[model samples]
Target: MALVAVLILTLLSLGIALSGTLTRLLLVVVPYAVFTLFLAGVVYRILKWARAPVPFRIPTTCGQEKSLAWIKTSPLESPPCLWGVIGRMALEVLLFRSLFRNTRLDMGQNRPVYPSAKWLWFFGLTFHWSLLIIVLRHLRFFIEPIGPCITALSSLDGFFEIGVPTLYLSDAAMLAGITFLFLRRLIVPQVRYISLFTDYFSLLLILGVVTTGLIMRHFFPADLLQVKNLALGWVTFSPFVPQGVGTLFTMHLCFVFTLLVFFPMSKLMHAGGVFLSPTRNLANDSRIRRHVNPWNAPVKVHTYEEYEDEFRAQMKTAGIPVEKE
Candidate 1:
């Protein structure tokens, strides 16, 4: 139901833009507003997480602690220092090391077996990396005299030379990855049971965007120069809806705008939240250093000496040995 609603909304938006009823509004105002909202929302979320105080050393450990000199410790698994934490975070962000080690349980004849879920990790990694490449490939539209790095990446992505307008591998990989992920949620009973409407909605929305983009790229073509001009205009703050940019492009932009507006508010913000996760970012140094709670309140403590002094008279009356005597 949620996926259907999102798809309808996207299609409706495209219809409105295609009808030329809100060309300027869709092209200029919507994009600008969405971008502003995306920035503000992301900032707000990060600041909220930043203000949260972690009063204890609670880094999730998966390996031996740093104790005896002879015993080897896995620095990346159970980070004991800042450098180890950084390295672990790098692997998590770049390669999704933790997810790569994900395990799935299977039950057979009243016994359970754990197996590595490498396929999920592979699809997830491919989806993210391909999406990133596609986004970077778009930098050519926004920037003037596109850098060598972007050019090199674009060349490599489109190396197949299958069609007249060379097809990029990232597009296919992204689509395949997304489809597999969506199907996985539906096919797997456990996953499907746990899945929320937003999960399906997000996947469908991204798939819609990618499909529309592919259509514009191959089937119903748009003027690349005009699209670039429009992008440049937006960046320059002198926004202009370029001529010859068809309804398909407008639809594509609408999907992108919707994504931007929804990103921070949705589970997609995990992209940023990963960096703030206490378990992943903090060093496992509880044994090495004492962690004092910054918000701890002052409390009056009764000393053993005070207790002994108070009981001295009672002890003497009972003919008991007293410290004072």
Candidate 2:
């Protein structure tokens, strides 16, 4: 149903673009609406999270902590300072360091056991890096006189010189990575059981967007200047509809806009949430110092000695160690 919805919506967008009835409406009104929703939604979500009290220094620790001068600590896993935290965040966001260490559980006879699940991480990294490259490569479409660095990047990306149109390695990598990710979700029993329709829908939507984009670039090329003008107009707050851009390009742009508009409201917000997460950002320093939650109310704690004192006679009769016995 989600896939069908995506197909229908994409086809509908294509129809609207082809109708030639309200080119200015989609070019101006739609971009403004989508941009506003994207901005407002993201700010609202981030603010909500910022206002929520964490109340504890529960940094997500996965390795040896900083303790006893003689023992070494995994700084990336349990950062004790800002520098370490920065490094940790870098690896986490860019390389998916934690996911790279992910393990899978499987039933062996009557027992359950964990096994390597690094393939998921591999594909995830590939997908993200390729997607980033692709987005960067797209700067050429939005900028006039395209910066030297972007031109260099474009040259490097299509260095293989695969064809007349010049195929990009990032494009192939992105598609392959997407395919691998989609298959992994289905092939892994645990992942498959935990996956929701939203997961499938997101994957399908991205794939559709990528496919349509590739089709536009290769099979049905459009006026690069016109597309760039449209993009620049949107950015400058003076959107204008450009002629010669195919309906397929419009549908692809719509899907990309949809993803951006829906991003903050969805689980995809985890990209930002991960940074704010106390568990992943806090230091494991409980052994060296106290971490008292300011919100915690004072309470009387019962001591072990008090319990022993109360049951001294009983403890002695039962042959248990009693201080008073």
Candidate 3:
């Protein structure tokens, strides 16, 4: 669900293991295999997308396009240049500009009224950002000499200073976001009608992962030294399961692995897909430049001159006017 951020968790969960052979298989071999599968699958999908042909400039323009010199154009919406397209893509990718602009149509007394429904965007953004932060925080385990930036981020995320373990704002935000999104599917008539099993499954997977992780951190703490060593061992290509890491963490880990293995084949690939999409990546200069289909075969045209030459004898016999006599 969180995309490539799952890479960090694969390292973190190296300590959650079973018996001798099973421990090596689950904690060590499984992480490597799943991560490998995730990476390969994602790359194959992206490359497949890249190979697909775009026949025309079909950018999803939202404003005035570049035409006459005097006409004002919305650069962000109808991006006409490379820089404008890049800027538009940056905003859409980082801030979800298009989603932020989402509107909902409401039937007033007898008329239609379009209103802002920003809560969906807000919750979606919150969930994703929090997930990203949590994933980044786990990098402290993988890297021996942890970067200052990672430490700073972790400190900032848990700066509330609420409890003995220090409650993380990201944890709270992620839980609230996931709950709101899940409830929306159940409560909203339109959303409920369209929601699929996969949609609910994804949310539940993330919720399960977050719930189990929170339990491990607060209620039943994992041995930090062993966990860190296991993580570092993964980083160094030598892995061993450390004893005393509970089954709860293992359960939490299975959820992460499920999400990872499911990610490349599922809708979660939108993280990678958004970049390859012609509608988002292309510049809106359709009127200015002709986008001939690259796949078109070479076409031969019979020139009027050639036709005139070929029919000259017939034209002369028929007493018809001819370009050349």
| lDDT string, candidate 2, 1-325, tens digits | 7678788878778777777765567777888888889889888988888888877778887778788789998988888777878888888998898898898888989999898888888888889898888999898877777999989998999999998699999999899999998887889787889988778778878888899899888989877778888899877777777876887887787788788877877887887888887777766677767888989899998898999988888888899987765
lDDT of 2: 0.83
Candidate 1 local accuracy as lDDT? 0.88
lDDT of 3 by residue, 29-133 (tens): 888888999999999999999999899888898899999989998998999988988999998878888999898999999999999989999999999899999
Which stretches in model 2 have alpha-carbon errors above 4 Å?
109-111, 298-325
lDDT score, candidate 1, position 172 = 92
- TM-score between model 3 and native: 0.89
Model 1 Cα shift for residue 73 (angstroms): 1.2
Candidates' C-alpha lDDT: 0.88, 0.83, 0.85
Residue 206 accuracy (lDDT) in model 3: 88
How well is each residue in 1-325 modelled by candidate 1, as lDDT tens digits? 9677776877787686667548777877777898899999999999999889888888898999787789999888899999999999999989999999899998967999898889999999999999999999999999999999999999999998879688999999999999999999999999999999889878878987898899999999999999888889899998876675887888888778888888898999999999999988899988888888888899798886788798888878898886666
In candidate 1, which residue pairs get closer than 3 Å at backbone N, Cα or C atoms, i.e. clash? none
- On the 0 to 100 scale, the lDDT of residue 115 in model 3 is 94
Highest lDDT: which candidate? 1
RMSD in order of candidates = 1.9, 6.0, 4.6
